[model samples]
Target chain A: MASVLASAHPQETVYGQVGDATVPLRFSSLDEEYKVLRERAAVLDLGGHGLIEITGPDAVAFAQRVLARDVEYLTSDRCMMTLLLDADGQVVDQVLAFGREDGILLESSCGAGARLLAHLRANNDEGVEIADRSGDLTVLGLEGPYAWGVVGRLIDGELASLPFESVVDTTWNGADIVFARTGFTGEYGYQMIVPIEHAADLWRQSLEHAQAAGQEALELAMLEVRQPIPRHEVTEGATVVEIGANWLVDVTKDEFVGREAVLAAFEAGGGRRTVGFSGGDGVPAPGTRVWVNGQDIGEVVHAVHSVGLGATLGLARVDHDLAAAGLELTVGGTEVTTLTSPYIVPKSWSIPII
Target chain B: MTIDELRARAAERQQTCSQIKKMIVSRLDLEIDPDWITDDQPLFGRGLELDSLDVLELYVAIEAEFGVALYDSEMAVFGSVSRLAEEVNPALRA
Candidate 1:
């Protein structure tokens, strides 16, 4: 699926196939876009992300059973990021779930909407109404240390400070839209779920305040903050514990789809844990062997040349005993040092919303 | 470092991270096991879903538990358990 606003994109836009959707990989260059995302603000065409709506009386109940996190008290004005897991506790997709007055709206990770919709429909024993709302609604994002400023200029100033995970039903160009303080890159981020007809206008207006960034830059910034990227990190048979996404699972919930398997994995323990590493000559591909001296401990799960770090940043699923940061590990033939999470401290952490 | 030496170093950071995790869980009264919180999982905004108030509580908890005051430190200090481990136990830092 191509972005709904692709017609408005620049002629120089570079696009790539990512699963079910064809997405812009970069507008100018990855480095330029990445710098904008971290230092200033970058507008994102998140049309590749699927928006699925679940309604009817059992909407919340059905959502409660399907979502890995506790959303029982998730009010209409709030949204939270959680994982949709299969029976085996393997991730289906990481989603931003918005609580709507009628039911719940889920924004699937870029290019994973179809799979998420299928997973939800297959498990919908509660007979709730499931609809793929992507045709009618699409997502746009603004992220960076100064993304809050763009939010104020583009929409409402108050919405910029709506607290993290907070959502509001509002308008843009007189079109009913849902605005949420959602982020992927650990920066001051906000998402606008607008009607398809009004998406192009919002995207253009946003461009005036922020430069456009594509999927590559967005994913790179997310990696820097150690945000779980399901596409890159969720390898086959990799348990949530091994993926280091335990926080996305609500083990405390009495019953949820993958709770049993996730709990079992956690109790089983001693699985390979994922850690961040840097300082490699080239980006290592997934499954590249990670070595500690002569011992083959694990493999690279995901990696990229981080523009922020000016080095190759990657995650290795190493044995639990050797997963901590500040260790010298070899990936393939190049030596890399496992570093602390948030490999690049997000400037948003220090910048407050004014 | 050699394999054994690297293992020892990794173990040292892991121990400190474990202590920090335990302190966070205990102080915040979280229900999950401290070990469940991975060394690399984010601690605020997205991962653990900690808020500013939680940070305030953690500030006191960290000083009491580690005998190190983080009152003046930037919010980046709590980026993750491993990051916090570095601040609480400076020896764990690279």
Candidate 2:
């Protein structure tokens, strides 16, 4: 699946294959685009993310059973980020679930749509209607400390300050769209779910106010904020506890698809836990060994040269007792220091929406 | 540091983080177990999803529990349970 706005993108845009979709990796240089995303606003072509709709008499019931969070009373004005866990408590995808009048709409993480769609269908014992809406509907995003200003110029200023995860059905340039105050990079972010026909136009108009950022820059920002990247963080046999994504799972909910397994893992405890580290010279591979004074504890989950920190940043899943921040750990041949979450404090944390 | 010494240091920080997590869960009336909260997991806006009111409650709770006043601290101090550990137990900042 290619982005619907690919034609509107500059000819020099770099594209990469991520899972089942061929998507833009960067519109410009990674450093440049990442700077734009953190300092100002950057437009995003999120069409690579799959949108699946669930509607039927048993729609809410089906969603309740599959979603990791409790969404029993989710109204049309709200949306949430939750994990789609398999029966074994492994994450299938991290999704943005929107409450709709009919039932619900799920936006899968980039390029994981096909897998998420298959999972939804296979688990459709309730016989709810599952429609893949990616063909007609696509998503665009604005993110940065000043992204709210872009929303004011492109859409409505009032929509810019809507509480986090607030969704509204609105019109943009005579096209009906679903606008939501959703963020991935911890910036003041908003997503516009527009029709594929009008997507190019919206993308072009957005480029006037914000530079286009692609998957590489977006994912980098997400990593700095310790956001869970399903593809990189969810290793084989790793439970939700090891992924440090317990916040996404509503353990209070009685009977969701992976609830029992997740709770058991939490109760059983003493598994490997993920922690952030920065100091290595080069970007280490996913399976790089993490060491403590020559004793191998675990391996790296994912890593990259972080534009925000100007250093190599990575997540290491180590023995549970060794996962806290501020410890000195070794990866490959270099010494690294374990760090706290949000390695780079988002400029939006200081900048207000107004 | 030797492996055993590093483990001891990590345990100290983890213990502080656990206490902070218990304070957050109890002060905010969250239902999840205190141990469920990871040291590096975020505490505001995304991970724990604590709001401004929850922040106020935590501010009061921290000063009462740890005898440390965070009234003048920046929002980043509450970035995570581990980050908060550094704040309440400054020894962990080493």
Candidate 3:
């Protein structure tokens, strides 16, 4: 799937491993690509993300038992961010579940589709049908302040009216397409899923539409800066509470895969919380050791030079007390200060009505 | 109150507002200068554009700085710097 995108940018494109796939790390200069996303709209190919479908009479029940978020209450029009966990409360993957008439569609990070599908099958006592649809579906991300406007020109009906995490199935150029008001970027954005055969056509049309609207297309490098924490940071050993994703854990639910462990961890106060840090003279690469007064506290998970903030920003798992804003820490022998996530608060965060 | 006392009180209030503005910038690690934050500019929506989680950080900052614990019900006072200033002054006086 990525070969199609690679063929387009023969001069400036570079590929890197995201999950199991080698995706475009950048199409051109990182700063310029990032600038387009911050100032205007840009389209990104997120074909690596895993898509799985679970259907049957017991689909909702099976999902509710396995996922951290309350899947039982999710309706056909809405989507919810959830986490799949091991029995020991370690995070397996972060997933977004969209409720549809046939069943529930789950989208996970790259390289996690098979594991998630296997987990579902192992726990499926209710005869739910599970299928991995990653190869068949292509995910495209449209981001920036003007993303809504660009998407509005391509689809029917008013897209602005759709709330965040709302999913709507629509047709584009005689082919079926699904649009979700969800994105990793802390801006107005949408994720469009199309059939694999129509992906190249959709990608071309989306870029053309965005360019016609005086916007530039972006690549994965731009998207990385927008995300507060990368998925790799929360891999296998990390818990939801430790990652500061406690909001996604529905404690009111009677049971889930790792509910007991998570509850116990919550009561005991999980160690090594995820914190956002910025204002360092040098960008701390991922896996860099974070220190406090010469003591090794945690390690950097995601780091990037934020052109918008005019400083290097990174996310790390540090001591919980040090996670508060204004605390100073050392990364690679240089001092850096902590800040809250969504490092650059977008106008969308201000729109309380949404 | 006498004119002199009223003037003194106003000056003290202005000082507190300035302090809170600086505290907001420092505690939130805001990129902009403290002086850039106008009194009427909102702390959450539109102006500063802080989310609810950021508000939690601000709560901790306010308590640690002014020894005033902000209750959830008092969050309405965070509409603007002036509003927060108005709420914090009485707590400081107490």
Candidate 4:
């Protein structure tokens, strides 16, 4: 409805760069990347994140017991989203888990590595050891259009079949790296972690490699760091399902922590939901309230200025009755209608690029 | 916002002073008598160990009776039923 109205606060986060490495933290640069990302494609260099390696005879069993998702079935080329929960079923942390020939590696929200390693150690039994590989590894992202092609050409073995959630073990650029097909852009992307010394070298190689491939080369562009505000949002644990990622939850995933509580809450019948809204053609900030027929039903979780679709689109968790795409909502005291259609893809891009 | 009104709303949600007290006891793993929770003692206080998140659960429970708007104020106060009555009844009346 409204344009990116000049907000009181400008999103001016810093971008760190060294010789050739950079982490785009500012919204302007990030936004430019998002634009390039939609039109052609771009590979961003994410340097601050780290990694953890879980190894031992009982690594899978140990991880499954402590993690909210079952990791026993994890193979060399697949990744799983699991929550590391305290006994109270409250989140200790959220992690992206994967397994390969050598060990089960977990990359998490940065703050989780030490706490998770200690948790396993305190409760560890036979044949389990955890190591913080954050110092040992370097992370790289092959995002944008030629991401898969560049990676696909270098690595062998069914790389093309890797889906949004697939993780594979492969030797690329003469070193071992865990390739997880996932990213934050809601597109086809991959996040690769390898030896630290090779990090800068691989980054320079990948960029050099992408430009030579004839597609719009990945470049240094900024994107807005907008989280879906995680449905859990710390304060509203289990309160997130109704809004941000309802599709991500598998109510059928056997018994798990907070499963019963979420189901109980579901039965009791009031979980906030994410709906879509637009003010003629303006974007609303995430967490803006949604009102309908004099009732406060939900809030916005994702918003985008769609250049492709030519309209402002958003994802909000709203009242069940008002969930239909055409329903109207009052956000920040402004009236707008919720629409389910997205500004970009006909399908959602939830997994990271591998 | 009155104690009676809140109690009535909680009652509609099938919650009572005893039930609320029992929940507070069990949820926090405390052993105090359910009766130790008084209508006037602050839901959170110098004597109470409940944190901000516990207050959120309490607010969610109370929302079943009065709408959540009762807590949306400039000062953001919601401590006890009686105090809540003093705080919200005026706003409702105004």
Candidate 5:
């Protein structure tokens, strides 16, 4: 036990491990005080992500062969957002792949980890290995407009020199870490990947930054960053000729597992159509029926108040004709005018300035 | 054409799939002939053509069926038909 303690790296910081989450900052909702925290300094603990480290001779190639996107030429300093699909071409998980000097770290929704590891093993005959760091790696999200400058101060310049999506190693208050310019919250953010022993130090450091800035309105400003921008939701079982995600298939990449089938689905058009809806204040729940022209068209997938925009926003797959923007849609049973969205545009923090 | 062959084939390919395959089965209240939903057959887009949400529902079904919480890291394994069957079938009996 003494050796174990000796081997553990220590950093200077504090973190709030709230609720029942195994990780920190995994809050159900940002606190009212965070409004002050977000503008100046707000760090969140993302508990739902399962962190997995991949290392082996064939790690890169094996991943390339199985996933839909190409990661063949990724640099250790970059990150790629990609998807994993079934043989039939349905998406299973959307992932962020961070390449490191020794290996690649994949972070995604917590629930899918076990199934993801199983898939890796199935394709593992070629000499790749997967390690689960869900317990070992503690992830912290430091976000805000001022986040970059503050993190730069903390890491002593390693943060500023690194561009978004890049990963670098540096010592923070005496603890060694893998600092990546990656975050789920769209901000000039950084995700500090640390050993569990050092989490408290890092958290404390972030809290210090927030307090020092005195801008306390950090989390409230972050609300503007919380809008749910609909990338695409896989609409299996439901026809999907028009939700716009059908365009996601890129044939130029390595022959994906479900290429021909997706192409075929594309050709057979007339699938269900999806549309965006922005209501006044009422947030629609998933599976809530949608109506158009006095008939049931479809239902809501995922919806939220869109903190970034202040309007309720959602993505709904409906019958073809009504999926277009400007088409009126009511909550399957209520009166709600679905507005076209820009709903809340994200304030750009990383604009290139000469 | 037969149930055992279909089951074997499906159980073989279920790994390359998302949850869509199983979701359709449940929502439609349909059962594989055990000869169908096989590996040799096309299950996702054609013949089966499962979409993304269906894949998610399939994820829920597998968990409910196997009694194991599926995580995102293991998604690739559940990416196919055969693979999911391997995990799901055993867990069903366990």
Candidate 6:
């Protein structure tokens, strides 16, 4: 189904594997897409992300036992970021769990659907039903400071007052669509989920609306800059604490899988910490070794030349001691100054005072 | 101020420090005991080993607990429990 959207950029699009599907990588120049996403608004195809639906009476209770967040406390009108972990506290998949009226919907990496479903079923206490809806659902990502305006124009209800991570259901031309005030681009954005039949039409309509409204379409690469921590770093053998996502883990919760392991790691002090670096001579490719004091400390997980920040930014999992900002580290033999994540703050989302 | 008044003021400051220390421990989900947090021990780097994210969480927790807002520029106040007490006590009094 995403191939329909990918077809639009036939000449300029590059294909990349995201989970089980090959989605459009770049519709145009990376820099242009980055600029559109930063300065204005842009639409992105998030069709590659897997969507899973869990229903029945035990759905929420079962999820609360498996996921690493306070799933039981999640309100039906909102969504929360959660992590699936192995018994050893290693991250399996990062997911956004949306509490729905009927059940819970989980959006995760494409390839993780089967595994996640299997894990859920193995622990299922009966009266629970889980189904992979990735093939039936298509997600469109609208991001930037002006993204809310684009979404506000399409939906019938008022979205201006909606808080982040809140989900609202609406219809477009008789097609059922769900818009969630959530995104990975560190901007005020929405991820719209529509039925597969309406996917192509909705994608085209969203693009047409943005274009008519004088906004540009962004490629998926724009996500590289806005991500607080790249997905690979979190999924590849990095614990939640090591990635500085301790806030996501509810240690007070009773008996979630990997809770004990995570608690132990936190107590014993987790290993390498993920930190951001910038002002480098060039963009250090992923897996580039990071050197400190002539010693190999760690390697870069992801790096890109950020047009918005006007510097080559990279996220690296380095020694915990060197994770502090303003430290100088050598990445791919070029000196880079370490800085914190969200190098460029979005104009739309403001940090709440309380 | 009189000697008794000075003693009472010192006691109030000490109570604030303990409250802040407990908040940090509970909020960050740290394993360390609140009693281990000395008044002068640095919250970041060598002392508590808290990184930038921890500082942000601590700021939010402090605001939620004490109704005192900590600005990004005033991060140095988080350098020690005593400093946090100094910042939070006035707000609590107010």
Please write out the lDDT profile of model 6 over residues A241-264, one tens digit for every residue: 676555456676777889988888
* Candidate 6, residue A330: how far the Cα is off, in Å: 1.7
What lDDT does model 2 reach?
0.92
Largest DockQ belongs to which candidate? 1
lDDT of 6 at A273: 70
| lDDT (10s digit) by residue, model 4, range B1-94 | 3324432443332233345556566666665445334322334311243666776666665555444454544212433333344332334212
- Interface RMSD values, listed in order for every candidate: 1.0, 1.1, 15.9, 20.7, 20.8, 14.9
Ranking by TM-score: 2, 1, 6, 3, 5, 4
User: C-alpha displacement of A236 in model 3, angstroms?
Assistant: 5.0
Candidate 3 lDDT over residue span B9-69, tens digit each = 4456557768998998798887554644544344552246577788888888888888878
Which residue pairs collide in model 6, if any? A19-A111
- Candidate 6 reaches a DockQ of 0.05
Clashing pairs counted in every model: 0, 0, 0, 36, 77, 1
User: What is each model's TM-score for chain A?
Assistant: 0.99, 0.99, 0.89, 0.72, 0.77, 0.89
Candidates 1 and 5, the one with greater TM-score = 1
List fnat per candidate, in order: 0.94, 0.75, 0.00, 0.00, 0.00, 0.00
lDDT of 5 by residue, A215-319 (tens): 112322322332212222445553222434332334457476666665566667555555556774577777888764556667887566554455666777665
lDDT of 4 by residue, A1-354 (tens): 110111311346344432222334443454454555654445444444436777887787777666666677888777766566554445555567877666688776433455666666776665677887777775666655445666765565356446665876667768887777765543456777777666666655665544211111122111121122232233345442453332223345565555665445445654444444566546777677776555566776656564444555556665543444334467767776544223234122322334
**Model 3 C-alpha lDDT per residue in residues A188-213, reported as the tens digit of each score:** 77888889788877878777766311
TM-scores of the candidates are 0.98, 0.99, 0.75, 0.60, 0.64, 0.75
Q: What is the C-alpha lDDT of each candidate?
A: 0.91, 0.92, 0.67, 0.50, 0.52, 0.67
How does candidate 5 fare on TM-score? Answer: 0.64
**For model 3, how many clashes?**
0
Model 3 chain B is weakest, by summed lDDT over 10 consecutive residues, at: B1-10
Off by over 4 Å in 2: none
Off by over 4 Å in 1: none
